[model samples]
Target: MISAQSLTKRFGSLTAVDAVSFEVGTGGVLGFIGPNGAGKTTTMRMLTGFLPASGGKAVVAGHDVFDEPMQVRRKVGYLPETPPLYRELSIGDYLRFVAEIRGIAARDRARRVGEVMEQVGLSGWERRIVGSLSKGYRQRVGLAQAIMHDPPVLILDEPTSGLDPAQVAGMRDFVRELANDRTVILSTHILSEVELLCPRVVMIAGGKKVADGTLDEVRHRATGGVRYRVELKGEPPDAIAPAVGALPQVDQVKPVPRPPGDGPHDPWDQGFRVLDVRAADDPRTAIARLATEQGWTLRGMERRVPGLEEAFLAIIGAEQ
Candidate 1:
C-alpha cells in the first residue's frame, strides 16, 4: 500500500530526509520513530504529498506521490502532530467540511461524517464547537476527519501525545481497529506504544535511515549477542565484580539497578548483588562453572532479551 525508494528532501543546503526508503504492505502497521528534529515530519509530508522530495520516489495506494499527488492525497489519511482544526467551527460543521474536501459525494457527506464521528467516539459531538473541545476531543475530531473518507492508508504522528491513560488506550485501540485492513504508519516517541501496535519499525536519525526491521531483529542487531542477569552471593563481597569479570567468557558486566524491596533487613539478602553479564560467546557453561568453583550462592541466573527501548538507545546513542 505504501512504498518509498531513496526518497530525499532538501531545503537549500539542508537535507531533511536523505535517501530514506521503506515499504508497508496492505494491512501492515509500521512504527516510524526518531528523536525530535530527526526529519520524521518532513518524511511524512513527502509521503502525503504535502512536501516534495528532492530525489527518489514514493507511491501511496498505487499513486506516485510526486507525479500523482492528488490521487495520493485522496487515498491517504494524515493526522499530523497538531490537530489541524478550525476552532470557531462546530465539530459537525468541521467534519462535514472535511468530508466535502475529501470529495465525498454531496448527498453522502452527512452520513459519512456521522459514521466517522461515531467510529472515533465523536458521536453526538457534532454540535460541540471545535474550540470548546478538550485536547483529547480535538484529537478525536482530527481522527474523525482523517477517516471521514475511509482512506486506505493512515499516517499518524504522535497520535497520543497528550491524553489521560484512558484516552491513550482508546486511541491505540482505534488505530489497531483501523489497521485491520489498511496500511498505517504510526510515528511516536513512545517505544511501548510501538511495542504494542507495530510488529515492524523503521527508525531514522539525522535525516538518515538508521534501522528498519521487526522489533526483535533490530534489538538483536543492535546488541550483537544475548545478555544474562545473574544474582549471586559470594565471599568477599567487594570482589564480586572482579570475580565475574575474570571469567574468560564474560565480555562485559553491568550492575543491575536495585529494585524496590531489595534493601530489606533479611539475612538471605546479605552479600548478594545483581549484575548483567554480556557474553563474549556462549558463556553460560563458563558462568556456572565459575560460580561452583568459587562457592558462590547463585540466587538466580536468567538469559535476557534486549528490549526495544534498550535497542533504541544503543542505535541512537551510537549515532551521537
Candidate 2:
C-alpha cells in the first residue's frame, strides 16, 4: 500500500536519506531498522509527507505523497518517535481533537475514538489527564489518537520505546493485532521486536538501503554455509578437531572449552571437548558415523543459524 522510488532527502550539506526505495503491500508489516543518525526518521517523515524529499517520489495508498499530500495524509496514521500529545488534555479530549482534525465524520467520531482506545488497551481511562499518565499509558493514548480515524496505513516510529518489559510485550501484541488488515511500517532498533512482529525487514545504514527481505533471506546473505556445535566423548576437543576437519563437507573446525558443570560423566562423559563446525551442507550424519567408527559416543549436536541481530551487524559493519 506504500511505494517509494529513488527517494532522497538532504539537509544543507548533509544527506539524511539517500536514494532508498522499497514497497509495502496490503497487510504487510515492514520493519525499518537502523542505528541512530541513520536517517530512519527522515525517511519516514518524507514518506508520510511530513517532510519534502529532495528528489524522487513516494505513493501512499495510491496517492503521490508530494502531489496529493492531503489525500496521502488522510489514508495514513503516523506516530512519530515522541507521541505528539497535549499533556493538559484528558485522554478523551485529546483523541476527540485528533478525530476532528482528521475529518472523521462528526456522527462517528465518538465511536471511532472508543474503538481505537479499546484497541490500544486504554479502555475506560478516557477521563484521566494525559499528562498524569505513565509513559506506557501515554503511549497507548498516542496510539489511540493515531488510529482514531482508522487509516489504512500506519507508520509507527519506535512504537514500543521506553516501555518496561511487560509494557513492551503488551504493545507488540497490540501492534500485531492492529496489522490484521492494515499495512504497517514500523521503525525500531529492537531486533527482537522485529523478529517477533515483522514478516519482512528493510535495513538501512549511512542513509542508504542496505538489506530488504524475509528474515532467513537476509540472514543467508550475512553467513556463509551452516554452522554446528558438536560434543564428543572419549576425546579431547584438540584431538577431535583435525579428525572432524577431514570430512569432505566440513570447512573448518575449532575446539572450545566446555562450560562449567557440563563435563565428562554427564551422560556422554563430556570433558572439555567442543567443536565449532562450519560445513557446506548437513554433515551431522558423516560426523556421527565417524564417531561411531572411532568408538566415541556423540553427546550433543546442534545447528546454529544467524539471527536478525547478526545479520544487522554484518550489514552495518560492512558499510562502515
Candidate 3:
C-alpha cells in the first residue's frame, strides 16, 4: 500500500531525510522509530505528500506522491505530531470542515463525522468546544478528523505523545483497532508502543534507514546471535556445560550463578541455574537427550529473544 525508494529530503544546507526506503503492505502497521532529530517526521511528510522529496520517489496506494500528490492525499489520512486544529470550533464543526475539505459529499458528511467520532470515543462530546476539551479528548478529536474521510492509509506522528499512562493505553488500543483493515505508518520514539501495536518496524538514525523488519528479526539482527536460557536438575550445571558445548550447533555455553536464597532441596526448582547458550542452530533437542541419558532431569529450556529496547540501543549506539 506504501513504497519508498531512496526517499530523501533537504532543507537549505541540511538533509533532513537521507535515502530511506521501505514498504508497508495492506493491513500492516509499520512503526517508524528514531531519536530526536532523526528525520522520522520528515520521512512521513514526504510519504504523505505534505513535503516533497528532494530525490528518489514515494508511492501511496499506487499513486506517485510527487506527481500525483492530490490522489495520494485523497487516499491518506494524516495527523501531525501537533495536530492542526481549530481551537474555537466545536468538535463537530471541526470534523465537518475536514470532511468538506476532503470533498466528502454534503449528504454523507454528517454520518461519516458521527461514525469517526464514535470510533475514536468522541461521540457525545461533539458539541463540546475543541478548545475546552482535555488533552486526551482533543487527541480523539484530531483522530476523528483524520479518519473522517475513511482513507485507506493513515499516517500518525507521535499519536500517543504527551498523554498520561491511562490516555496512552487508550490511544494504543484505538490505533490497534484502527489498523483492522487499513495500512498504518506511525512515528514514535516509544518502544513500548511499537512492541504492543506494530508487527514490523523501520528505524532511522542520522537521517538514514538503520533497521527494518519484524520485532524479533530486527532484534536478532541487532544482537548478532541467538541466545537461550537452559535449566537442569539432578546434575550441577558445570557437569553438563562441556557436553552441551560440544554439539556441532553450539557456540558457547556460560553458566549463570543461581540467585541467593535458592537451596538444594530441589536445586533446579530452587532457582534458575541458567546456562547462557549461544548457537549456530537450535540445540535444545540434543541437549535434552544428553540430559536424559546422563540421569539429569530437564527442568526448563527457552529461547531469549532480544527486546525492542535492546535492539534500539544497539542500533543507535552503533550510529553514534
How many pairs in model 2 have backbone atoms within 3 A of each other, for residues 3 or more apart or on separate chains, i.e. clashes?
4
Error (Å) of candidate 1 at residue 22 is 1.0
**Arrange candidates by TM-score, highest first: which order?**
2, 1, 3
The sequence of per-residue lDDT tens digits that candidate 3 reaches over residues 178-240 is 899899999999998999999999999989999999988898889766788888755564667
Model 2 worst lDDT window (10 residues): 263-272
Cα RMSD, each candidate: 4.1, 3.7, 4.3
Angstrom error of the Cα, residue 27, model 2: value is 0.8
What is the C-alpha lDDT profile of model 1 across 95-156, one tens digit per residue? 98998889999999888887888899888777899999899999999898888888899999
Candidate 2 per-residue C-alpha lDDT over 146-217 given as tens digits, one digit per residue, 9 for 90 to 100? 787789999999989999999999988888988998999999999999999998999999899999988778
TM-score for candidate 3: 0.82
What's the true lDDT of residue 51 in model 2?
A: 98
- Candidate 2 TM-score over all chains jointly: 0.88
